[model samples]
Target chain A: MEEKLVSLPEAIRAHVSDGDCVVLGACLEAAIPFAATYEIIRQGKRGLDVAAPISDTSSDLLIGAGCVGQVTGAWVGNVSSGLGHNYRRAVEHGEPHALKIRDHSNLSFGMALLAAAYGMPYAPVRTLLGSDILTSNPEFRLAENPFSNGGEKTVLVPPLAPDVTILCVQRADVFGNCHFWGSSGVAAEAALAATSVVLLADEVVPPEVIASDPSRVLVPGYRVSAVCHVPAACHPAPMTGRWQRDSAFFDDYHKRTRERGGFLAWLDEWVLGLEDHDAYRTKLGASLEDLRIKGEALSAPANYAAH
Target chain B: MADYSTQELMIVAAAREIRDGEVIFVGMRLPIAAFGVARLTHAPNAVGLFECGIARYEPSAETLYTMADPANQLGAAWATGLLPMMTQLPAGRVDAGFIGGAEIDRFGNINTSYIGDFKAPKVKLPGSGGAADIAASAKRLLAIMNHEKRRLVERVGYITSPGFLDGGDGREKAGLVRGGPAAVITDRAILRPLGDSRELHLTSVHPGHSVEEIREHTGWALKTAPRVDETPPPSPAELDALHRVDHEGHWR
Candidate 1:
C-alpha cells in the first residue's frame, strides 16, 4: 500500500464520508485541526455525528458552519463562548439534532469509546446513576442496581465507535506515528475508538526519533490513514506549537460575538473572508503585530512577578 | 473584613478562607475570577491551578485569559511549566479547590454537566474538569454560586463530585473524604455540613437576604448559624481590584 502525506483538508476529504461518526480530541481552542474542519465544512456533508470529551472553538465552529448534524458531548461553552448563535439556532429551531450529556455522562462518552475500541459490548460506568440522567436518557439505563442487596449498580453505556478521529499534535513522523507532550490520552482514546485516524502535525520528523521515545509515542502509524503537516494550523487560537495565540484577533472576536449583529459581521470578515489560516493572519495585519507584543507582555517576567 | 461589591464580595469571602501559599484548583468561569481575585489580593503566594494544567499562574492584573494561554506560564516563579502543572493536578497535589455549579444538593454534590435530560438535554454545559480529582484529593473545597431553587436542589441531576457519598459514615465507607467541601458560599448565604448526615445548613446570610429567602431556595432543611452575621460589602478598592483582574465584568 502506498502511504499518503498531504494537507489536513486533503487527508480528511480522502477519508471522511457522509453519515460518518467522528471523534475529535483537542482543548478548548487548541485541539481541532482547523484545516480539516474547514474542509469538512466546505463539503457540507450532513448526518455527521461528533463525540468529543469537551467541545471547544473548533467543534463549535464546525457546528456553526453547518458541518456537524449531530453532536454528543459534555458542554459547549468556550466554543465561540457559550454556544454560538448558529448552534443555538440549530438545536433550538430543530434544524439539527444535539444530545447534551451531563458531566457524569460525559465521562462515560469517553469510557464507552474506549470500551468500543477494545471490542466490548458496553462499558461499565459509575457516572449518572442516582441522578435523573439514567431515568431520562433511554440511551443510558441501569444494568443492575448495585445499590440493591449485593447487586451490581452498573450504568451501562453503549459503545461509541466513531468513523474517523481527527487530532492535531505538536509533532509526528512521515509514517503517522505521533507524539503530543501534553494531554494526549483523550485524543488517543478517540483515535483508538474510531475506525480510521487522521493526524495533523505541527512538524514532520523522522519516524525513528518518534519510535525511540516509547513513552512519548501517543498514536502508532499503523492506526493512522494519513498524516498532514500543517504548521500553526490552529490559528486565531492557540496550539501547542512555536506560534502563540493571536490574542488581538481573539479579543476582537470575543467583543464582536457578544453583539448579535457584530458577531455575524465579524464572522463574515474572519471566517468567510479568509481562504485559509494564512489569509486570516494577513487580514489582521498590524493587529497581529500588536497581539504579538501583548502576548509577549502577557507572558513577560514582570507581569508574572507583579501577579 | 473588606467591604465587597457582589463580585468582590464573592472573591473576598472565598479568598479569606483560602490560606496563603496553598495550592488551590479552580474550575473555569466564575471560579477562575474568584481564584484571580484571591491570588491578587489575599493569598498572593497561593497558586492558581486550572484543569488544563496552568499552575501557580500569575495572571495579568487585567483579564483572566483562557486557562490554556501560554501567558499562564509567564508568572511562574518556579521552573514548573504547563505540562508539569497539568500532571500534578491529577496526581492530587492541589490543596484547595474553588468550583461553581448549575445545581448543588444538600450533600454538596455538584452538577455543571447538563440540564433537563442526559441523552437529549435541554442545555449542555462544560462537564467536570478535574472536579472529581479536586473534590476527592483537595484538603479543602469551597463552592461559590448564586442561590436559587433550581440550583440549590435537594438532589443534583448528576453527582460530578462525590459529596458525602452515601451519607453518615458513607464517605468514610466510600473512602472519598481526605477533606471535602468545607464551605459553600452563595449570593444569599453560606452553608456548612451538619453532623454526619452530609447535609448543608446555613451559617450566615448576606445583608438584605432573609433566612426565608435562603430557605425558599434550599430544597433541604436550612440550618441557621449560632449567630448569623452579615457578610461585609466590597469596598471600592476591592471592587476596582476585582474589575482590574476581570475587566470584562463577566465575573460580576
Candidate 2:
C-alpha cells in the first residue's frame, strides 16, 4: 500500500482532473517539470487554472497547448531567452486562446501558498505594501495590522490551496519520499499546501537510499499521492547537480514559438505529436544525452537499474 | 580611448557604486552580471542574494552560468530556501538590491506590469518577480535601466515598485522606512533623490552622454546636481573583467 508507482500519463490521468487549479513547482530555471506538463497537454486536459510563483517553461507550454484557462503567476519571462512568446500572445493578443491573469509579486504569491501550507486563513506580507500589484488585484486587500503600532497597512493575501501540485525532484522512492537539491523556490511551500501531489523524479531510488540521507528529503511520502519516474523531467530547465540549463534550447523554443502558427506547429511535433515522454526523449536523442551528467548526490543510490 | 558598449559602462558604474562587504540583493540578467563583476573586482566580500534564495552567493563572473541554479552557482556561502531569504528583504538585512521597470517617474515609483492600463489595451509586461520586494526592502535601492524617454516618464502607468510613493513622507506613511530607491544608474547619467523628496535629479553624466540629452530623455522636468561629475570611462581592469564575465555579449 505504501508503494506508489504510476506512469507519467497515468499520474496525470489519475491526479489531474478537469477544471482543477493545478499548481506547478518551478523557479526561473531550476526543477521545472516540463515532462509532466507535456503529459497534461497530451492527455488533452482543459480549463486548467495554472498557478506558479515564477514561470518559464511549465506554465508557458500548458497555456500554449490550450490546456490552461487562467494563469496566476508572478513573473512569466523565459529568463536569458527573453519574453515568453506564447504567454505574450495569450495575454496581449489572445491569439490561440484568451488567458485570464491574476498577478502577484513572486513573494506575495509564495506568501499566499505558505498560508495554505500553515492552514491559515490568510498570510500577511510586507513587500507588496507599496506596489501596484496590490492596487490592481482586489483580492489582495490591505488590512490594518491589529498588532501594527496603529497605522501600518498590511496586505492580507488569501491562501491558494491548489487541487494538484506537480513537481520535478532529483530523487524519490517507491514510497514517495522526494528529495531535492539547489533552490526549491516555493515548491516546498506549495507541496505542503496542495491537496494532492504528483511527483516526477529524475531517478527512483530504493527506500533505503532515500532514507540514507534524511536531510535531502523535503516532501515526505505521506504527502505525495503518486510518484512517477521520469528522467530529464526538467528539460530546458536545469536539474541541480545533473545538468546545466539548456539556454540554447530556450533560444530555439522562443524563436520557434514567436508566431501563433509556428507555436501550434511546435506543439504538434513536441507535445501532442509525441505519444509520451519516452517518445519525446527518443526524438531528442543525442542532444538530450549531451545535457546529461552525474549530479553530486549525498550517497550512492540504490541503483534500481532504471530505463 | 577604449571601445565599451553602453551596457559595460553602466555595469562598471553600478559595480563601483556597490561598497565593499555589503549584501546586495540582485535579480536576473544585468543586475546579476554587475554583482558578479563587483565580486571579482572590488567587492570581494560582497554577498549576492538571489531571488532564488541562495544567500551570500559568489558567482564566477567568467562562467556566467545561471546564478539561480545551485549546480552552476559556485562559492555560495549558504544554500537555503526562498522563505528565509525572502523574509530577510523586509527585515532590512540587505544593504542594497537592483531593480528595473518599463517606466520610472520623478517620485521614483516604477511600473513593470502594464504599459497603458491595468485591465485594458496596450502591452502587458511580465509582472513583478522580486523587483517589488527588493525595492521595498533593500536599504539602498539602485535602479538600473536603459535611458529612454518612454522609460523615464512623468508617471508610470502603474507603480510596481514603490520608490517614494508620492514624495516626502510618502514611503513612511505606507510603513516603509529603512530602504527605498536611493539612486538610478542608467546608460546616460546617474540620478539621485533631490533634497527631501524622492524626485530624481541628474547627479552625473556618462562620458559620452550630455546633460541636455538626459534631461530631454526624461519625462519630467529633470534637474541637475550642483556639481555634475562626468562619469569616468570604465577602467581597463573593470572592462577586462566585465567582458570575460559576459562573453556571450548578453550584457557586454
State each model's CA lDDT, in order: 0.63, 0.81
DockQ of every candidate structure? 0.22, 0.64
Which pairs clash inside model 2?
A241-A295
TM-score of chain B of each: 0.83, 0.92
What tens digits encode model 1's per-residue C-alpha lDDT throughout A1-307? 2455776657767789887887764353454566666567666666677666554555655666556766665445453345344444445444334523223333456566767778998876544443434443468756665555756456677888889988877788888888775333356667778889988787898877676665566678888888888765556555543445665555555556554466557656766666765675577577555444233222222222334
Q: What is the TM-score of each candidate against the true structure?
A: 0.73, 0.94
lDDT string for model 2 (B175-209, tens) is 77678777899889999988787678899899877
- Residue lDDT tens for model 1, B184-247: 9997788988786867878877777888878988877777766777776765655765777778
Worst 10 residues of 1 chain B by lDDT: B78-87
